[model samples]
Target: MSHFSGIWIPIITPFDGGAIDHGALHGLVRQYVEAGVSGFVALGTTGEPAALNEQEQGAVLDTILSAAAGLPVVAGVGGNHVESVLERISLLNHKPIAGILVAAPYYVRPAQVGIVDYFKAVADQSRVPVILYDIPARTGVHLELDTLLELAGHERIVAVKDCGGSLDKSLSLILDGRLQVLCGEDLDMFGALCAGAHGAISASAHLMPERFVAMAKALEEGRLSTARQLWHSLVPIVHAAFAEPNPGPIKAALSQCGRIRNELRAPMTAASDDLAARWTLILNKVVGSPAGLEQS
Candidate 1:
């Protein structure tokens, strides 16, 4: 479970001239790793894995693995198609991926049993540990707490990315004492940590990994005053990145910080100019100290 905690950034795969910007991707990993993110998530929603082809995904994976220099890389292998997800994981069996993160089926909206079995099948076959992704809004179904508990100790099911939009779920997991809980909601990050969550896996970290890590570490160290100040400062930034859908505000924030050229694939647009400018104000004026990764 320790392998899965802390401020982990669901990295945004940079695009330039209609191609995966490996150079920018490399820079982001380096920056975040230096900034103190415990791990990196490639091809997640922020990375726009849906828009990338298999070859492009493979290439981005290779680039990220190479750039990461040994930080844990959780490949975004989850989707509605279980078979294809399994195939993708099989293809990645040899890669040095820390784990696979798969969301439950969307649109089809399977029963809890089906969702349980779906992840169990993936976990059963995965070469690495698995983090069940419980994003009810995105998946169109919740990773019911009982269902998750049933799957909690299953083979390779070591951790959870619990963004069910509630600290109650996170608290329940910690109380259950079966699985480690990592809060996936930026808005509720401190509350989750306060509720005994181990750490956060937030998209906002992509904008200010240093600040996010700092807030987590402060909370961990019992410095509530400092943590509160930082957390308040962070709310606006988090709000900005999520204003136009994830990775939009984040990518724009990163670009404002000069980390990358803000670009996105088709079907996923970048933030409007107004939002981008607003993100700059939030990042520069509000968040002063960068969140450090090592302490967290």
Candidate 2:
């Protein structure tokens, strides 16, 4: 079966003492695995891949792989330099990961053709299946529909993390059905699933993962009402997740749950006090009462 389906957490990298806290990282992985996440996306945007050096990134991936406890894990490999990315993939090729999640080259904003060639090069070199990440907002270029459909034809390019921001294109890909579509945008997950996208690789799942799992299961099981109810409840928390930059708000929420420290690397500050207060309030309402946060 395709390993990319269902609610997968692009886990936040826990920090303590200005380093990647492996202890906190392990605990977080175990928490998600027990919470019933389908798998994990290590070193993805939510994990702050840009903030971590290469050695730190590898260590983080290794830690997550060890703690995943048999759950499938996909590693994120992204950058504007093809050679550098290829070297990274070459190293990752030796790992026991399920797949690699790669994005279009950032900043350079390559053309659609360049985008296609870039992904093709990565897929050609990657030993595992490739899950294309189409987050143009960060990557600075969109993988046009033709580019995506073309990439789908490649045997190694098995799926896509759909964050290109076009409902029409998203629906087209779903209808084409060659590539499995996993929603990358937290807020769009329910709608994408309703439109027949396979599942989600959600950062927001780091908080209340079971709820996300239940919601996805409900949709697939044809329980529309149950899915809607769950989606509505999750909407507020999803808003809070992206309220600041990413990882910051998510780290804050996780900290409140005692899953990780409420810290982030340089240039990425902690969530504002106001945002934290708001998150606490929303978390309580959606997750449970005041006592539940402490207990959870």
State which candidate has the highest lDDT. 2
lDDT value, residue 165 of candidate 2:
93
Tell me the TM-score of model 1.
0.93
State in Å the error of residue 50, model 2. Answer: 1.1
Q: Report the Cα lDDT for residue 49, model 1.
A: 86
Q: Model 1's lDDT to the true fold?
A: 0.81
> What would the per-residue lDDT of candidate 1 be over residues 1-36, giving only the tens digit for each residue?
446778988888888888778898888788777888
For model 2, the superposed segments whose C-alpha errors exceed 4 Å read 289-296
- At residue 216, candidate 2 shows an lDDT of 95
Instruction: Write candidate 2's Cα lDDT for 238-284 as tens digits.
Output: 99899999989999888887777899998899999999999879977
C-alpha local distance difference test of each model: 0.81, 0.90
